[model samples]
Target: MTTASGGWTVIQHRYDGSVGFYRNLSEYTDGFGNVGTEFWLGLSYIKEIADKGNTTIRMEVSAADGSSAYEEWPEFRLGDAPTYTLHVGGRGIGTAGDSVRYFEQGNNGSDFTATGSYCGDIQHGAWWHNSYCTYINLNGEYATPGTRSRYDNGWGGMVYFSFKDKSSLKMSTIMIRRND
Candidate 1:
């Protein structure tokens, strides 16, 4: 987290499979895991922060070899519950290629779906899916590098698609900072 700009809250972070991310809607809504470790800060909390004022989102992904990439969106806002929809604006700038904003027209307005999950194709995990799927499924299952092949064809792992064409991830972190 860039300490230079304070108030940057970590919305999600995962470095290992210690905490299961394949959870239900309730778990996603209420949040899970440890803030000091693998955790998702919860949609409710994310909404509250977004509602307060303008915000920016940053996503960083790394491979087992320590190679990493990051993406940043200048504008971000999450909707309220029931739908808990997502709205990410502006062209993301980073090494991750703005994958979230390039999934079939865009996943910008996709709803936060947890049922069946992973775009209803497989049980990768809950995420802000655009019906079919979102390119960036950071909340997907945690598949070790050795266990990636078996799940590659189905995107069954914590992955940032555009990074390596469904490449398995070793670590990832998402943070949001308010502009006002």
Candidate 2:
């Protein structure tokens, strides 16, 4: 499933992590002139091992031209029930560089609580160009250059999930969404 808004698109995917250490759940293309993109994911029916603190999950995004960025979450205990919701995305709100945030929520009885939150600048990575806006000639069509628009370089990207101890986990749901 997929949804779009103001030039950004999000797709949902289903994944089963019964036998691997890493799983690439979904991938997306942000066209050719988007400022930033966001992804939200949910995992259910989790089966964790006795040593849960070593298990990990990750989300990665890359430009169609090869530029990329990624963020990973910390380990959890077996008794935590394993279900989780994660959010990863970039925002063009700061002057230094594009601001990025990664957040995680773990299931607890009838509710979920924030487990992790991280912030960074997209310019720190070599995959992305520091210029917030740039002109591009697309199939003979000309586009204006500048950050006046929120999305200027709608590059392609992907989302992935990884586990440290594969034998202990069996995920049932891999709900994913993209937001601008």
Candidate 3:
């Protein structure tokens, strides 16, 4: 069977000298009836291995359709390397057929306009953008930017940053609507 959009696999390491594995293969419907999938894989060293207390574990992953971006928030510390790489080459699709279009205003405080921002494709993935909105350009368009958007695909994933005249600005975002 084909994996769902958000299927996941998980592996666990218990106190015993054995390992456990689990996979979440089916999609789920939220309160709004929208369907989504999720999968994860984790490993645990046997009690003998963890007792050492200084061993480090390494991990590698390959995924698409925003699967690779899902992760738990790591604690804030020095020298953290949370990285993501996407291998996509083509003009992504939009809600209105193959055209790209979207509008954004109040970006960076200055009034600017951009085109080619309507990208909501599922196969080619969608645009994902996170910016330091200084001037707040209320009108901007992103064309094949490869950065996910909240307007499409319910939650095309994204990371954002903001500042308020030197002081830290707390960013606020809403989740995608759950429905067909």
Q: Which ten residues in a row have the lowest lDDT in candidate 3?
A: 21-30
Candidate 2 residue runs with Cα over 4 Å from true position: 1-51, 76-100, 104-180
lDDT of 1 by residue, 1-180 (tens): 454356789999998889988777788888999988899888998889888888888888898667888887867888878778888777888887655556324677888887565463373677778755767778878888424524437476777777766767888898999987
lDDT of 2: 0.21
Each candidate: what lDDT? 0.76, 0.21, 0.19
Worst 10 residues of 1 by lDDT: 145-154
| The candidate that achieves the highest TM-score relative to the unseen native structure | 1
Alpha carbon deviation, residue 113, candidate 3 (Å): 25
Tell me the TM-score of model 3.
0.17
TM-scores for all candidates?
A: 0.89, 0.24, 0.17
Q: After superposition, how far is residue 3 of candidate 3 from its true place, in Å?
A: 8.5
Ten residues in sequence with the least summed lDDT for candidate 2: 117-126
Candidate 1 clash pair list: none
Ranking by lDDT: 1, 2, 3
Clashes of 1: 0
Q: How close is candidate 2 to the true structure, as a TM-score?
A: 0.24
The TM-score between candidate 1 and the true structure equals: 0.89
